[model samples]
Target: MALFVGLTGGIASGKSTVARLLSARNIPVIDTDLISRELVEPGQPCLNELCQHFGPEILNEDGHLNRKTLREKIFTDSSARAVLETILHPQIRRIAKERAEQSATQAPYVLVVVPLLADPKVQPHYQWLDYVVGVRATPAIQKARLLERPGIDPPLADQMISAQSSDRERDAIVNEWIVNTGDLTTLARQVDQCHHKLLMLTAERTSSE
Candidate 1:
C-alpha cells in the first residue's frame, strides 16, 4: 500500500497550487474537489438529491448545476450548507478513496486533496489517511487570492474564509504544514522539501511492511 497523504486548507490558501506542484513532480493526486464536481453532473444521483433539497432552480436551463446559484444559497444559509455537505461528502469520500487505492499501485504515495479535512464533521471521516498536510496562508493573503477569482467579492470571500477551519485548528491535526504566504518560487521550494520527506517516509514504510 502507498502512503496516503491528505492535503487540506481553507479556501484560497493555495491547496490547488500545492497539488499542482506535487503533480508536476509526478505524484499521483486524488482530489475530492474534482470528485465532488463529477458527482453532481446532470444525471448523477447526487445532483438529483441536490435538486430535491434545493429545488430545480439550482440547475441551469441546460440541466447542469448552476454553481453560482447554489453557492449563493448555501453561503447565506447554514442549514443549506450542512445539507449540501451531507449529500456530497460521503460520495466524494468513497470515490476519492477508491481512486487513491487504484493509484497506489502506480506511485510511491498518493495525495488526496480535501479542502475540508479540518472540519469537525469532515475530519473524522478521513481517519484512514496516513498523513495530513495543511497548506496555510495569512488571512490577508487568502482574501486577496479569493478576490482574484471570478464572481467572488469582498463580502463573499470573507464569508467563505470565515466558514472554514482556522490555521490554528488545521495545525492541530496536520502532520506537516506548508506555509503559502509567499510567491510561487517560495511555495515550490516548500513543496519540493515536502515531496522529499514524503518519498523518504514511503520508502521507510515499505521496508517495514
Candidate 2:
C-alpha cells in the first residue's frame, strides 16, 4: 500500500496551505474536506443519508447542501453536530482511504489531509497513517483569517473552533509539525521543508507492491 500520510491541523491552521504546497510538488493529496463536499453532491449516497437524517432544511432550494444553514443548526446543537460527523465523516474516510490505498501502488506516498485528525474522536480511525502532520496558528491569526473566509459568520467560526481539538491535544499525534506563525512566504518555506521530508520518506518506501 502507499505510504499514507495524514496531514491535519486545527481550524485556520494552514492545513489547506500545506495541502496546496504538497500538490504543487506533484504529491497526490486526498483531502477529506473535498471528499465530504463531493460525497454530498446532489445524487450521492451521502447526500441521501444526510437528507434522511437532517431533513431537506440542510439543503438549499437547488438541492445542494446549504452549508450555512447546516453549519448554524449543528454548530448550535452539540449532539446534532456529533451525529452529523458520524454520518459524513464515515463516507469521507471511506473514499479518501480507498483512493490513498490505490495511489500507494503507483507512487511513493499519498497525502491524506483530514482536518479533524487532531480531534480525539477522529484520530482513532487514522492510526494506519505512516505519519501525522500537525499544523498550528495562533488564535488571533486564526480568528483574523477566518473572518475573511467566504460566507463565514464570526459566531459560526467560533463554533467551528469550539468543535476542534486543542493545540495541546493536536501535538500528541504529530510526527511532523508545520507551524503557521507568520506570512504566506514563511508558511510556504516551512511547508517546503516538510515537503522535502515527505519526499525522503516516500523514496524510502519500497516499490515492491
Candidate 3:
C-alpha cells in the first residue's frame, strides 16, 4: 500500500540531491537514469537494439556504449533521439516500476526519480504514480551546473538543456515543485518540508487502504 512518488526535473536540476536526502531518511528511491545505464551495459538487449540502429561505431573498442558519440548524435538530431527513446524508455520504465514495487515492501512510500516524466510519450506509462514532484531550477542555474561537468562546453550544455522539457512545462504537471536555485541549505530545507508532507500523505493513504 505504499505511495509511489515520481520525482522528476530538467537535466542538472538537482533531482539526485533530493533523492539522496530522501534516501537518508529511510525512504526508498529508484532512479530511472541508473536503470537506463544498466539496461545498456555490454550484453543487455537494449544495447543490442541500439547497436542495430546506431551501428557498431556507437560502441567503444571494449564493446561498451560510446556515450559521447551517442550523446552527440541524439542531442544534435531530434529524430535520432526519438528513435533511441523509443528503444529504451519502455524497458527503463518497466524496470523502474519493478524496482519501486520491490521497494514498497521496505518503505512507507517509494520515490522513482524519472528525468522525462514530462515527456508526452513517457508520461502516459507512469499513470501508476500517486504523486509527481518536480525538482526545478532557473535556466541560468541549470546551464551553470551543466557547465561544471567535465568536457561540457557552454554550447553543449545549452543544447542539452534545450533538449529537455522546460521548467514551466514540468511545473505545470507536478503536484509539488522543489526550487533548487539557491544554496544546499535552502534545498535541504525544502526537501525536509516535502518529506514531512509526503509522510503525512502516506499515512493517510495507508489508513484508507
Q: What's the TM-score of every candidate structure?
A: 0.97, 0.92, 0.97
Candidate 2 weakest ten by summed lDDT: 200-209
| TM-score (C-alpha) between model 2 and the true structure | 0.92
Best by TM-score: 1
Which should have the higher lDDT, number 2 or number 3?
Answer: 3
lDDT of 3 by residue, 43-102 (tens): 999999999999999999999998988998899999999999999998888899999999
Q: lDDT by residue for model 1 over 49-111, one digit each (tens)?
A: 999999999999999999988998988899999999999999999999999999999888899
Off by over 4 Å in 2: 205-209
Poorest 10 consecutive residues by lDDT, candidate 1: 163-172
Candidate 3, residue 101: Cα displacement in angstroms equals 1.0
TM-score winner, 1 or 2: 1
Candidate 3 regions exceeding 4 Å error are: none
Q: Compared to the true structure, candidate 3 yields what TM-score? A: 0.97
lDDT of 2 by residue, 1-209 (tens): 45789998888988898889888888788988998888889999878887898888898889899988788878799888888888888777788888998777765678899887877778888887989888898887888788898888788788788778878887888897888988889989988888778777776665433
* C-alpha lDDT of all candidate models, in order: 0.92, 0.83, 0.92
At residue 110, what lDDT does model 2 achieve?
83
